[model samples]
Target: MWKILKYSFADLVRSRWSYVYLAFYLILGFSLLFLNNDLSKTVITLMNIVVVLTPMIGTIFGIMYFYSAREFTELLLAQPIKRRNIFLGQYLGIALSLSLSLVLGLGIPFLIYGIAQSSEIWDFGFLLLVGTFLTFIFTALSVNISLRNENKVKGFGYAILLWLVLAVIYDGIFLISLVLFDDYPLDRFTLAATMFNPIDLSRILVLLKLDISALLGYTGALFQNFFQGSGVFISLGMLVLWTVVPVKLLLRKAIRKDF
Candidate 1:
């Protein structure tokens, strides 16, 4: 597993797309800071981008990696290795590389701007953490999609559809549902709905931590009321579950799968 992980990470690091991702973030970080010297404001702008972009990119990368690595995966199946380990290692490698790209890409500019001396360090750290979590969650989801679909085009299509539903469509439905049933209490329903979608959960979690949930209006207030206390821990646990469940399911599938 470790060897596979090491090679996978190395291979990805050497890829052109990896460098492009890193460069893109580097430019984004520098540009955001240049446009706005306020770290807090920059973090907010980044939050919007991170919440949507990371998951989409992770989905795309996961699907592409799984399909591209098929030949390699087949070669590994002939070796004395557990199928789950192969997939898990590849999955982890991709997630870590992308997470690293995000952290360093955004972190470097912040550090140069003396973010360490500022009060927004923790907020910035939390942003990176959520980004990492999204990367893992979405990548695992994409891998699952890829594993189930042998056709590359169909796999890519499914992956994009998954991202779209989670990142965009889910929020639309949640809002419409809230509007349609505005008279009734929706605290529990809203909370459950947020938990079901990683993107929503992440946005709420970060905004709650930044103490800006109030800006979101009613739903924000509800999130603030709930997440301000021990609910934060619960939110974190859900994020962990979001990452773990898909990974576990994919691993199980990988084991019984015909390679």
Candidate 2:
């Protein structure tokens, strides 16, 4: 398992796409800081970038990795190694490699700026955790879809559409709901709405930490107060659910697969 993980990490490190992804984030982070010397502005910019890019890269590369490794997976199945081990080893390897890239790409820059400006490290830490978990969640989803379907294009399309729905469409719905429920106790509804979309929860979590939840309106304040205590654990647990359930279903399918 260790050997497989080592090789998988090496492969990811050698991939030009990984470097390009890292460079893109690093440049974006630095550019934002250069453009705005304000710590709050830098943190907000970083949060937005992480929220948008982390899942995008994770899904795309994760699907590609699984699909491209079909031949390798087949060869491994021929060996004496257990199928479960191979599946888990590959999943962990990919998750770790991608998480490391995200940490380096976004976390490190945020840390440098945070320290220099004496910013709140907790907020930045929360951002890093969000990016890491988001990557894991999306990667698991993409890998599951890829394994279940033979066509890489279709699998990849599913991931993109899923992202769009969770990140964009869901928010649009939330806005419409806010308009419709103008007088009701909408705070609870907002919280319930967040449960339906991890992206919404993540965005609320980050902004709440930055003391910017007010921008989200009344429901945002409710989210801020509700998640302010043990909310971190709840959010983390939700992320774990997002990763585990899909992978569990996928693994069951893979084990029973004729390949």
Candidate 3:
């Protein structure tokens, strides 16, 4: 597993896209910090982008890597190595590479700006943590999609569709549902629904941590009140489950897949 992981990680790290990914984050981080000059606000803005962008990147990269390495993967399958190790190593490699891009991209600017001296340190840390989780979760999902669909085009299509539903359409549907049923109490319903989507959970978690859930209006306040206590733990727990389940499914599929 480690060997496969090391190879995949090194392969991606040496790729031009990896440099571009890292540079983009670095540029964005510095730009945001330069323009905003406020750690809390910057962290909030970053939270919005990280939650959406990481998953998309993860999905695209995972599927792309899987398909691109198909020949190599088959060669490995012909060897005596465990299928679980091969797939998991590749998955982790893609996820970690992306996560590294995210961290270094954002971390450099923040650290330069002296986030260590700021009160938003934990908030910023949590934001990166959530981004990493999203990367891992989505990468695993995309790999699963690739494994299930032998056609590269179909795999890419399904991966993007999955991201769209979770990132954009899911929020749209959630809001529409809330409006349609506004006559009744929706606190618990809203909470339950948010838990269903990792994106929503991430947004809420960061907002709550940054002490700015008020911008979410009544809904935000409701989230603040409910999650203000032990609720953060519950949300984090859900994110953990989100990250773990997809990888489990990926491994299960990989082990049983016919090469």
Error of 3 at 132 (Å): 0.5
lDDT of 1 by residue, 117-150 (tens): 9999998999999999999999999999999999
Q: Candidate order by TM-score, highest to lowest?
A: 1, 3, 2
Regions more than 4 Å wrong, model 3: 214-222
Error of 2 at 54 (Å): 0.7
In terms of lDDT, the poorest run of 10 residues in model 1 is 211-220
- The all-Cα superposition gives candidate 2 an RMSD in Å to the true structure of 2.2
Give the RMSD in angstroms, all C-alphas superposed, for model 1: 1.4
How displaced is residue 170 in candidate 1, in Å?
0.5
Instruction: Give the alpha carbon lDDT tens digit for every residue of 121-225 in model 2.
Output: 667777889998888888888888888888777888898998888879889988998999898877777677887677777887888788665755554555666
State which candidate, 1 or 3, has the greater lDDT.
Answer: 3
**What's the TM-score of each model vs. the native?**
0.97, 0.91, 0.96
Cα displacement (Å) at residue 156, model 2: 1.9
**Which residue pairs come into collision in candidate 3?**
none
Model 2 ranges with Cα > 4 A deviation: 111-117, 181-184, 214-221
lDDT of 3: 0.92
What is the clash count for each candidate, in the order shown? 0, 0, 0
- By lDDT, the better pick of 2 and 3 is 3
